[model samples]
Target: MLNRVLAVALAAGLVAGLAIAVLQHFTTTPLILAGEAFEKPAGHASLDPAAGLRFSGATIILAHSHGEGAHDEAGWSPTDGLERTAFTSLATVVTAIGFALILMAGLVLSGDPIDGRRALAWAAAAFIATGLAPALGLAPELPGSAAAPLLARQIWWMGTAVATAAALWLLIRTPGLWAKAAGLLLLLAPHVIGAPRPEVYASGAPAELAGAFAATSLVVNAALWASVAVAVGFFWQRFKPHAS
Candidate 1:
């Protein structure tokens, strides 16, 4: 039983980790797109009939907006090429594997054996503490978009919590084909709900700038949940089949 549990945990962890990494890599936009507008310039032009005079002037302005709101998104750049993408993916994979190993060690020491009920409880706690709370803006703002809409942030967080809970529940309760399908659906739920769109610039922005800030949030959130999942799985494994 222990062996079976461990095998399943490892396999699930790997898939979760890989998904997180790939999502992060693809979603990460160039640093330029992550910035906020520092200023907004304005000008006015008028013509006078009496003197037949025309006047036009522009003034410099500044703002606190940062990240996704900074400049026309056209300024942002994508990763140099496929090679850089591969490197990022590899980095995420390594981090995921390391996290899994650590979780396995912790589970072995928790004095309880892994089981469905325990896994569900742990996952639930994690979802509430880490996922739900952050969705409510209890968590710090992400680096790229300091000015991201509060409502949008809340939506993202709520979606994330639901997805995580569903995935964990399915994995712990029913480890079968249908359960796997449900888990995958949970994983992809956020994409369907979509993220906040960047405010359009009158001047136009770069093409690669599409969904830059949203992508960053997705990556960061995924990493956080992936870490929690591995940790919960490890600890659950340790406490399962505890000797009374």
Candidate 2:
């Protein structure tokens, strides 16, 4: 079981991570670079510049896995695009591994045989739950943007992700009116409750750029999750025969 998990995770993570890293280089990373210009007073690069899916928060979570010192928001940053890009790639792979584990674990718990079609469905649901659900409440933020307390926002995002996933499971796996209604409520609950709100609406970056950042985060996440699902799904089946 352990070997199977590791195999699927590494495969999925590398494929998904590399893909998203490329996507962000062109899509979200530029926005972050632009936003950083407004963050520092010197108008030079900020210390510990931001990275992949910078708006979505995944990059930070994953980068820590590579090494505790990989990213230090407090430290001074050098103007090294190559280093930043390399780190971003590492972050993406690490993040993908974590998410792939979750995906594969869900399948194991469900006792379902893996296949491309089912994997696609799983990936879509995962994307909806983890990516879209939280995003609905908390769109990605740029530097210098007004926002809620970090802990509060994290709590809300987590709750939304869990609720959305539960709702999806209920709707897809269970039948009957009660199950359906419950699923619907779970789906709507978080949005109705709403995400953590900013205390004051403000940002150093232009409103347009901020909007672009948020939209790009959502789009990139959707694609990343979908691709991850497919890759993991393919490898899971391929690796299954050897797990025994």
Please tell me which predicted candidate would have the highest TM-score against the true structure: 2
- What's the TM-score of every candidate structure? 0.35, 0.81
TM-score for candidate 2, residues paired by index: 0.81
Write candidate 2's Cα lDDT for 128-177 as tens digits. 99888788788889876778999999999999999999999999999898
Per-model C-alpha lDDT, please? 0.50, 0.78
Off by over 4 Å in 2: 40-73, 76-79, 240-244
RMSD of each: 13.0, 8.1
In candidate 2, position 40 carries an lDDT of: 30
RMSD of 2: 8.1
Per-residue accuracy of model 1 over 60-122 as CA lDDT, tens digit each? 222322245434543543344585567766666565555444444434555545444444455
Residue 38 C-alpha lDDT in model 1: 19
